[model samples]
Target chain A: MSTKHTIAVLVNDQPGVLQRVSGLFGRRGFNIESITVGQSEEAGLSRMVIVTTGDETTLEQVEKQLYKLIDVIKVINLSSKPMVARELALIKVKAEPSARPEIMGVVETFRASVVDIGTANMMVQVVGDTVKIDAMIELLKPYGIQELSRTGVTAMIRGNA
Target chain B: MSAQTPEVRSTEQLREKWLKPEVITGSEILLRSLLLEGVECVFGYPGGAVLYIYDAMYGFEDFNHVLTRHEQGAIHAADGYARASGKVGVCIATSGPGATNLVTGIATAYMDSVPLVVITGNVATTLIGTDAFQEADITGITMPITKHSYLVRDVKDLPRVIHEAFHIASTGRKGPVLIDVPKDVSAATTLFQPDDRIQLRGYNPRTVPNKLQLDKLARAIEEAERPMILAGGGVIYSGAHEGLYEFVNKSGIPITTTLLGLGAFPSGHDLWTGMPGMHGTYTSNHGIQQSDLLINIGARFDDRVTGKLDGFAPHAKIVHIDIDPAEIGKNVPTDIPIVGDVKTVLEMLNPIVPYAAKADAWRDQISKWKAEYPFRYVDSETVLKPQWVIEMLNDTTKGEAIVTTDVGQHQMWAAQYYKFNQPRSWITSGGLGTMGFGFPSAIGAQMAHPDRLVISINGDGGMQMCSQELAICAINNIPVKIVVINNQVLGMVRQWQELIYDNRYSHIDLAGSPDFVKLAEAYGVKGLRATTKEEAQRAWAEALETPGPVLVEFVVEKGENVYPMVTQGSTIDQMLMGDA
Candidate 1:
C-alpha cells in the first residue's frame, strides 16, 4: 500500500521554519525521498516540495500534522492534482577516446546537454522527470560516472482553469 | 491658515488624541499584559536572568505571586490551577536548568490540554547561542510540546507576544504556550499599548459544527438501536457538561467517560456506566465493545482505551466530535468526524436529535453485567485496604472536594472510588501520568479557590518524588490535605512484574522509607498516621478539622493491584479480574 506522494507546503520564510517543518516529518516517521525549497511569489514566504513515500493513511496524517506547525501557511498534495514534476541532475562521466562517441549518442537520445568537457571526463546536465533522469544515469553508468549532483524534484500545478 | 486655528494643528496631535501610548520598560509591559489578560496570580521561581521582571513584580498590587521551591513544582501548580479553575494559569522560570525543569510539566499540560502560559527568562539577546551562563533555547526545545511559542528578540514585541500567549493557551483545544523573554528585552523600554488585539493569520480554530454533519449524526443516533456516549476531557474543556447532561437525559443513552473526563457528568447519575479503558468498569468496557453506535465526544481513542486496536468497539459506527481535527481518526477509524467545540456541537444536536424509545433489553444487559462483576476487594480486619480508605475519604468529603492525584495504582483507585459531581472537581495527571504531580497541583487548586477543600491522594512512592513541596504548603499556610497511601512498594509496576514477568520484582519494592508523619512534622505541618480503619476515619476527621496543612499517612496492605485490568495486546473483554 506504500506509494510516493508529492506535497507542496507554503511557509513563512523565518529562522527555524524549515527545521520545524522537517523535524515534524522526522518525528512522525514519514520517509522523505527528496525535498526542495525556494522563495515563493509572495514576499517573505517560501514554497517547499517534499517527495515522500507512505501509505494513504500516513500521508493524510502528514498533511494534517504539517498544518499544525506554526510557520506553515498552506499545504497541498501536488500528486492529487494535475501537476508537472521535474528534477535536474549534473552527471560527470569519464569519457576516454573509445567511449566519447557512445556517451554523446546516449546524451543526445535523452535530450541532455553537455555543460563541461574535460580531457578525461564530461559533465552532462539532464532535466526530466525522476524516472527519465534515473534512466539517463543508468545508461551512462557503464561509461563510468565520476560524480553526480541532483536537485530534488520541484513541482507545479499544470493549468490555470 | 492661522496657527491658533484647530485645522492648523499638526498630524501628531490627531494621532496622539486617538491612540494613547506610554513608554514603559519591558518588565512593566509584561505585568501590564498579564493584568490585561485577567491573570490574578502566577506560580514562579526567581533566578538571576529574571531579576528585572521580579523587581518589577515587587509592589505590583494587581497580581499575587507564589514562589515555589522548584521550577517543576511551579509549572505543575499552574497546570492544576488551570485544570481545576477552567482559566489560563501562568508560571515563570529563568533560563537553562530552570527552563529545562519545566519540560516535564509542560509536556504533561500539553498532553492533557491544560491552559497554561509559561514565561521563561532567557539570557541577554547578545549572549544567545554563545553558551552564555544560564542560557538555554527553551523555545526550540518546547516547540513540539507547546501550542505556540515566542522568543522575544525585541522589547517592542513583548506586549503583543504575551497577549498572543494567553490567547493561544486558553482557546481552541486549549494547551500550554511558552514565551521566552531575553534579559535585555526585559530591561529595554518600549511603547506600551494596552489594547492591541492579536491577529495571527494561521491560528483560526473551528468553533461551529457543520449543519449537515449534525443532521447526519442526529439521524444516525436516532436510527441506531444500541447507542452509547463516550466522553473525554474535551467535555470539561468546552464546558459542555450541561449540554451533555441534557442530551443524555433526553435520549437516555448510556454514558461512559475517560479518566480525564471523570467529573464531566455526575458519577451518581442513573445512566452513567462508569469509566472505559484499562482498569475501567466491567459494564462500561463491555458496553463499548458491544454497542452498535459509539458517539465519542472530545475524547481521543487512546491506546489504553482501545486495548486491541482491531477488536476495539468492533461493532460500533463511530461518530467522533472533537475540537482538534488532528485527533479525529488518528488512532481508530472514525465513521463520522465532526471538528468543532463539544459544547457548540452538542447544543446544536440536542434539539435536532429525535428521541427514540429506551431500549429496555440493552439496559437490562448492562445492569446485569454491572451487578455481576462489581468492583470488589477483600476487606481484612488486620490490614487496611486502599480501596476502603479511598471510599472513606469519599464518604467524608461527599465527593465535593477538589481531588488531585499522583500517577500509579493510587490514581486509578481514586478515579474508581471518587464520586465527582461537577467538572473541574477531579484533577489528575492523565496523559503523561507524571508521578510527582499531586502535591503541587493540590497547592494550585487550593490557591485558586481558597475557601474550597483540596485533597491530594498520593502513593508513598510517587509522593516521595516531590515531597519537598510539603514545605511550601507549610510556609505559605496553604491548607491542602495530603494523603499518602503507604503500600511500601511501587504497586502498579510490581503488579505488572507479577503478572507479566513471572513475579520477579526488581527494584519495585520501596520499603523502609522515611516516616511520612515525621517528615510532615519536620516541615511544621500537622502529621497524622493511621494503622486501622477506625484510626483512618479519626485521622481523616482530624485532618479535615485542622486549619493548617495536614499529611495523613495510611499504612495499607502491600501487593494490592488495580483490577479489571486488560493485559497488554488483549481485547477489553479479556480482562484479568484480579483476586475477585
Candidate 2:
C-alpha cells in the first residue's frame, strides 16, 4: 500500500546541497510530489519540505539514504504527526466585463485576494492547504487561466514548544 | 629582564611576531597534511592536471609514491593496503579519464566498506564549466558511490579538506572519500595551519550500544535453546576479533562467518562451523537453518547469504548488531536491532551473557551434519583439480601468508580450503565481486607488510584483467607471489550455464589466453608452471622461496565448479551437494 508522506529535512545551506538531496531522491527512484526549501532560523542552515508517495519500506529506505548524505542534518516524517501544511499560488485569469462578477464571486467564496487588475485580465493570490488551492484552481479554469505559479507545500509541527 | 627595550614595545607587537602564519602552496599543504595523517605510501599515476602536485611530491622523503601502470591499479592497490594493514589507503589520479578510471575501484571499496582516500586533480576553476581540456566533474560523478566528496575551489580550504577527507574515509562505516582539487587551487598559496580535530556536526556515527537493547539481547540469548553467531566484515573493520573470540568462548556458541569475515575468527577452532550461504560448508548452512536464535554481528544479510528471503533462517529470531542503521531491516526483518560498533557491542554483551553450555544436542547434531556432508573432491592423476592447487598452496604457506583473491571459482576455493588464524590475513572483493582486484591488492598488501609474504590466488580470466600490474611488482621489487589457476574458462559463469542454462556456454571460455609464465618472464620476474600435483607442490615451494615477485601458472582441470551450492531462489537448507 502506498501513501503520501511529508518529510522535513534540516541541512546545511551550502551551494549544491539541494542538488545533492534531489539527486539522491532521483537516483533512488522516489516519486516526489512536491518540494520546497527555504532558510531556517539558524543562519547557516536551511529547511526542506518534501512530499513523496511510497510504501512503508520505500519510505524507510528514502529516510535512511537521505541521512547518509553529509549535508543533511536531520529528517522527520511529519505525515503521521499533528502538523500544518500550506501552499501559495498566484493565478492570472482572463476577465471580460461579463465574467468579472463571477470571478469575484468565486474569489470571495474561497476567501482569496485579487492582487492585480488589468483591463483584460486579473491575478488572484491564494494561500491555503493543497486541497483548498486545488479547489480554487478548479473554479477559475472556466474563466480562462492565463498563467499560474505555485510555491510547493511547506510544513511545520503545530505546537508551542 | 630586558626591561629597557621591552618598555618601548607594546603587547600587540610581541603577539604579532609570535603568531606569524606560515604561507605555503596548496600542493605542499596537501603533502604535509597527508604526512600528519601518517600516510607513508601512495599509489598514483601522473597526468596533465596533476603536474603541480607531482612536482611538489618530488623531494618529499616522508612519502613513498608507487607509480602504477593505470589509474585502476593504483586505486585497487590502495584498497588492498587498507584492508591488510588496517590503515587508510591513499590513491591519486588526474582529471577526466584518469579520474573516471577510479570509478570501479571506488565502488568496490564503497561496497566492502574499505577505507580509502582518493585524490583527483581537476582543471582550473575559471574553465571548470567551459568543457576545458582534461576536465571532468569527478566529485559529481562519484556522489552516490563515495562516502563523501569535496571539490576544493579555494586554496585556503586545502588543509581542512584533506584532514576531513581522511577522517571521513577512516571513520564510522569506513568507505572511500574523494577530494577533487582544481589545478589552480593546488597552485594557489595559502596560510598552512594544521588542524588535527574534525568538527562535523552531521557525521557523528554511533559507537556505543544502548544498555537496554544489550540487556534485551542478553535475555534472548539466555532463553534460546539453539543460539548461533554469524560474524561479517564489520568484525574485522571494528577490530573486534578479540572481543568476538571472548564472547563466543564465554557463551559457548557455534560461529559461522561471512566471506569478508574469514580471518576475524580462527578457522580451526572447535566451535567454528565455517562460512554460511551459497558455496558455504554443509555444517554452517544447516546450523543456521536449524538455529532458534541467530545473532548477527557486523554483517548485513546479503542476498547471496539469504537465498529466498522468506525461507532464510525461518525459525530463528534474528538479532542484528551493526554500526550502520540503514543496514538494519533493509533486507530482512530484524527482531533486536542494536546499532553500534561491533567491538563496543561485543564488549558490553560479553559480561551480560550467562554461561550456558546447555546445547549439547544442538552441538551433536551439527557434528553429525559436518561428518555426513564434508567438503570433498576426487583426485586425478592426469589432471590437477583446482581445489587441490588451493590446498597445496594453503599447506605450503602454512596459512601464514596474507592472501588476496580475484572473483571466481578460485576465490571460493581459497575461502573453503585456506585456514586463517589471525585478523587482516584474508582480503577479497566480497560485496562487489570485482575481477582484477587480486594482483594489485596483493602488491598493496606487500607494501604494507614488507616482511610478511603476500599471495594472490587468481583465475586465468581475472588475472588477465589487471595483468599489467605485474610491472609495478617487478619494478618496485615487491615480493608478492601470484598463483594463476588456469581452468581455461570463466568457471563460475560456466557452472551456471551448465546447471541452469543447459550448457550453452557463451564467451565463457578463455582457451587461447596468453601464456602466463611467459608474461611473467616478459616483466623480468621469475615464472613457474605446474601441471601435476607433485609439480604444483614443488612450484609453490620454489615460488615462496624466490627473491622478488614470482608468477606460478597451474593448469588445472577444466569445468571445475564450487559446490555445496545454494541454487538461486532456493533456501540455504536446499543446497545441492556435489558428487561425493
Candidate 3:
C-alpha cells in the first residue's frame, strides 16, 4: 500500500537529471507519488523531497539506483527515521447558522485556521498527519463539505543547523 | 680467477622468467579480461590514442571487432547487442570526436537500461586540458549516462577496473559503464592480474523481495476482483519468464505487455492480450481501464499508454511491482507497492495469490472485446503490405527466431504481426526509439545464438542509416538476415504529418534511392526483392534458407501506415483504423 514517506535526494542539477530519475522509475513501472525540488546548502547542488513508497527492498533499490545516477550525491529515507512529517490541507465546508458553532468548535480542537469565508461556506486550513486531516474532514462531513485540496506530505528531519 | 671475472652466476636467477608486464600490455589485459567476462566482440573504430590497445586486440583473436560506420554506431551497436544478447556489450572509441560521437548512443543506452561498457582513449596526462587535438573530457560528458565511469590514471588499475566495469555493467538494474584510458596509460606496463572480486562500497544489488511486502502484495492480489497484469521488459532482464508465467497462470489473471514487454509472455498465448496503450489492442486497453486492481510488473506507464492521465484507470487501484523504488508512484497513484526484481516478487506471490474465479468474468468480457476488435491488415490488392511480410517471416521462422527491428511503422507492425513464443527473442528499441538499432543488434544476436536464425526487420529510412554496417556481416561470416520494408518514406512520421499536419509533404519522402539489390551485392551479401505477397513469401523462405547474411527488400506500398492507431490524446476506444 502507498505510504507517504519523504526522502531527501541530493543531485547535480544537470540537464537530464529529472528525466533520468523519472525514467528510471517509469521504466521499472513505479509511479513516484510526488516530488519537490529546491536549491540545497551545497554549491552546484540541488535537494529534492520525493514522497514515494515501495517495499523495503525496493525502496533500498531505489536509493541504490539513485546513487548510480551520475548526478545523484545522496538519498536519505526520511520516513524510516525519526523525522518531522506534516501536510497542509485547505478544506471548504458548508454550514448553516445552526452548524456554524459546531464547525468552529471542531476547528478550534484541531487548531485549524479559517482561511476564507463566504455566505454559505468557510475554508479551513489545517496542518497535520494524513490521519488527523482525514479525521477533521470526516467530522465536517455532516455539515456538508464543499471542496478539499491537500499539498501531499512534505517532511524533513528534525535537527540543529 | 673465473669466479672473480663474474660471468653472471647469480644468487636467485640463472634462466629468464616471464615478467607479469610482458604477459600482458594494459590494453591486452583489458581485452582478455572482457573476453573472460563473456564479451565476444567490441564495436568500435581505431584511432591514434588507442593504437596500442587496438594492436593488443590482435593478440586476443577470439574477440571480433565490429567496425561500425561511425563512433555513434559503435555505441548504439553495443546497446543493441546488449539488449538482444542479454549480456554486457562493449564498444571502443578514440578520444575527442570519437568520444563525443558516442554521447547520444550512451544516452540512448542509459534511457533504455542496456548493459554496455564504453571504452574511450584519452589524450596523455601531460596534454590533458591543454586544448590538444583529438582530446575531450569524455568522462565528464558521459557522467550522466553511465551507471559508473572511471578515468584510469595508471595502467595498474586497468585490469581490475575493466573487470569491475563488466561486473557493474551487467549487474543490478543494468546500465552503461565507461572506462576512459589516457594514451600513455595504455602504453605503460604494470604487473597485470585481473581481480575476480569487486569491492565497491555502494554497489550492492539485492535480488530478493521483502517478505512483509510480498505478503501485502499477495493479499492485494487475492482480494482484487478485476486483476490485470501489466508485464514489462524487466521480466526479460531478470530472466524471470518462467516465474511470470507461473504467477499469472496460478493467479488466473489476464496479462498485457507494454511495447517493451512484448515477449515477456508467449505472444500467441490465450492469456496474453497483445500490447496495451495508445496503438494497443482494444482488449488490453479496456482491461487496463476497467481493472479494479492492476498488477504492474516491471512495466512503466508511459504517456503513450495513458492517453489522458486524468481519465486513465480512474476507478482502479494499482499494485505496482518493480526493482527500482523510484517508480512506485512516478505517474499513476499506487494503492499497493512491491519493490523487488519482478521475477522474485512474482515467485513470492505465486503461492499466496489464490486462484480466484473473479477474474474469469473480466477475462470473458475482454475476450469479447478481442473478438470484436481484432488487429487487421488488408492485402486488398496486388501491392504487398508490410504486416504480411512480417507474418510471413514469423511463419518461415516458426516463431523460433530472434527478431530485431528499427524504429517506425515497420517496427510497430512487427510488434503487432510477429508472434514471439520465447522470451528475449524479440529485440527492438522500445524506450529510446533509436532508428538504426536493428541490423547491428541482429548481428550481435546471431553471434550470441549461433544456431538460431536472427532477422532484422527494418524500415527503408532506418536501413539507409546503417546499411554500411552490413559490410561487417559480409566481412565476417555472421549469418544474419536483413528484411527491409522499403516504403520510400519515413512512414510513421510522414503518416502523422499527412494525417494531422494537413498532408504537408516535406523532406520526409525519399522518392529515389540506391538500388537495394545492387547495394547488397556491392557488400558481397546476396540480395532478394519482392513486390507481391507470393514474391514476399518466396523471398522470406529463400532468405531463411540462405547460409549466410542476406538482404531482402520487400517493396511495400508507399504511403502505407499502421492502423488501430490511437491518435495523440485519444482513448483506446477511439482508435482510428486505416479507413478513418
Candidate 4:
C-alpha cells in the first residue's frame, strides 16, 4: 500500500516558516523523502515541493497536517493529477586525461554538461526527472564518483495555463 | 466652494484628532490588550525580565494576579481556571529557567485542549542567540506543543499578535498559545491601538458540518439497530451536554463517555453506559465492541480508549464529528468524518435525524451489563478503604463539588466512585497525566468560582509533587480543601509490578513521608488526619466546617489496586477484573 506522493504547498514568506513546515513532518512521525523551497510568483510568498512516501491514509494526513500550519496557505497533491516532476544533480567523477573523452560522450548522451573540470576530477551537472538522474549516476559508477549532490524532487502541475 | 474629496476630508479629521498624541509603554500595551480580552485574573510569577510589566500592572486595580512559587503551578492553575470557567486562562513567566519550567504544563494543556495564553519575557532583542543572561529559545521549544507562538522583536506588533494569540487559543480545537516578548520590547514606547478585526489567511477553522455527510449520518443512525454514542471532552468544550442529553433521550441509544468526558452526560440516566476504554466500566467496554454503528462526538479515540487499534469497535462504522481535521482519523480510522463544532453539528443533526427507537434490544443488554457489574467494594472494620473515602466525599458533597485529581490509583478510584451529572465539574490531567496538577488546579477552580466548593484528591506520592502550593492556599485564603489518600506507596506502579513483574517492588516505597497534619500547619493551614472510618468521618466534618483552607489526610490500607483494568496491548474487552 506504499505510495509516492508529490505535494505542492504555498506559504507566507516569513522568518522560521520553513522550520515550522519541516518540523511538523518530524514531530508527526511522517517520512519525507525530499523537499525544495523557493520564492514563488507572488511577492511575500513561497512555494514548496515535497516528495514523501506513505500509504493512502498517510498521504491524506500529510496534506491535512500541512494545512494546519499558520504559514501554509494552500496544499495540493500534484501526483494525484497530471504533473511534471524534475530534480537537479551534480556528480563529481574521478577522471584523468584518458577518462575525459569517455565522460564527455556519456554527458552528451544524457544532455548534461561538464560544469567544472580539474586535472583529476570533473563535475557533471544534469537536470532531469528522478529516473534520468539515477540512470546517469549508475553509468558513471565504474569511473568512481568523488561526490554527489542532488536537489530533491521539485514538481508542478501539467499545463493548466 | 471648492469640492473636497472624501479621502482628503478623512485625513484632515484624523490630523485634528491627533493634535495631542498619547503614547504608552509596551508593558501598558500588554495590559490593555488583556483587558480588551476581558481577562480578570492571571496566574504567574514575576522575575527580572518581566519586572517592568509587573510594575506597570500595579495600577490595574481590577486585574487580579495570583503569584505561585513555580511556573508549572501557575500554568496548571490557569489551565484549571480555564476549564472551570469558559474563559481563556492567562499565565506569565520569565526567560530561560522560568520559561523552561512551564514546558510540562504547556504540554499538559495541549493534550487536554485547554485554552491558555502563556506570556514569557526574554533578554533584549540584541542579546538574543548570544547566550545572554536568562535567555532561552522558548518559542522554538514550544512550537511543537503550542497551537501557535510568536517571538515579538518589535513592540508595535504586540496588540495584533496578542489578539491573534487569544483568538487562536479560544477558537476551534482550543489549545495553548505562547507569546514571547523581549525585555526591550516590553520597555519601549508605542502607540497602542485596539483592533477588533483580524485577518489570518491560513487559520480559518471549519464550523459548518457538510450537508451530505450529515444526511448520510442521519441515515446510518436511523438504520443502525446497535448504535452507540461515545462523547469526549469536546462535549464539555462545546457546551453540548444538554443537547446530548436531549438527543440520546429521543434516540434511545446507549451513550458512554471517555475519561475526560465523564460529566458530559448524566451518570444516573437509565440509558447511560459507563466510561469506555482502559479502566472503563465493564458495560461500556463490552458495548463498544459489539456496537454496529458508533457516533463519536468531540472526542478523539485515544490509545487508552481504543486499546488494540485493529480490534477496537471492529464491527462498527464510525461517524466522527470534530472541529480539528487532523484529529478525525489520527488514532482510529474514521468513516463519515464531519468537520464542525459539536454544538453546531448537534443543532443541525437533532432536527433532521429520526430517533432510533428500534434499538430496544441493545439498550436492554447494556442495562443488564450495568446491573450485573456495578462498582462495588467491601467495607472493612479493620482497615480504611480508598473507595469508601471517595464514596463518603461524594455523599458529603452531594455530587455538587468541583473535583480535581492527580494521576495514580487514587484518581481512578475517584472516577469510578464519584457520580458527576454536570459539565466541567471534573477537572484532571487526562492527557499528560501530570502528577502535580491537583493542588494548583484546585486553587484555580476555587478562584474562578469563589462560592463553589473545590476539592483536590491526590495520592500520597502525587500530593508531594506540588505540596508547596499549600502556602499559596493559606496566603490567598482560597478556601480549597486538599485530600490525600495515603497508601504509603506508589500504588499504581506497585500494582503493575505485583501483577506483571512478579512483585519485585523496585523504588515504589515512600514510607518516610512527613506527617500530613504538621506539614499543613507549618504552612499556617489547618491539617487533620484519620486512620479509621470513624476518625475519617469526624475529620471530614471538621475540615468542611473550618472557614479557610484545610488539608485532610485519609491514611488508608496499603496494597490496594484499581480494577476493571484493560492493560496495555490488550483489547478493550480483555480486562482484568477485581472481586468487588
- Least accurate 10 contiguous residues by lDDT in model 2 chain B: B1-10
Q: What is the TM-score of chain A alone in each candidate?
A: 0.97, 0.97, 0.81, 0.97
Report lDDT (Cα) of residue B213, candidate 3. Answer: 75
Q: Cα miss at A13, model 1 (Å)?
A: 2.1
Model 2 chain A lowest lDDT segment of ten? A152-161
Write down the RMSD of all candidates, one decimal each: 6.2, 6.1, 12.6, 6.2
Q: Which regions of candidate 4 deviate over 4 angstroms?
A: B1-21
Query: What C-alpha lDDT do the candidate models reach, one value each?
Result: 0.89, 0.90, 0.80, 0.90
| TM-scores for every candidate against the unseen true structure | 0.95, 0.95, 0.79, 0.96
Candidate 1: where is the Cα deviation over 4 Å? A96-98, B1-20
Task: Judging by TM-score, tell me the better candidate of 2 and 4.
Answer: 4
Better of 2 and 3 by TM-score: 2
lDDT of 1 by residue, A16-135 (tens): 788788888888899989999999999999999999999989988999888877678899999988899999999999998778888999999999999999999999999999999999
> For candidate 3, lDDT tens digit of each residue in B1-580?
0112334433234211211335556776776667667666788998988888898876444556777778876777787678777988889999999899888778878767788999999999788889898999887777667787888887888878888888888877778998889899888876667567876644666668778877777777677788888988889988888998898788888889888888789977777889887677878888888888888898778787777777788667888887766666767778787777887777777878777566777778877887787788667468988888888888777888889999899999898888887887888887778888787778777766878888889898988877888787788767889999999999998989888899997789777888898899999999999998888888878887889999999998887778777788766656676762
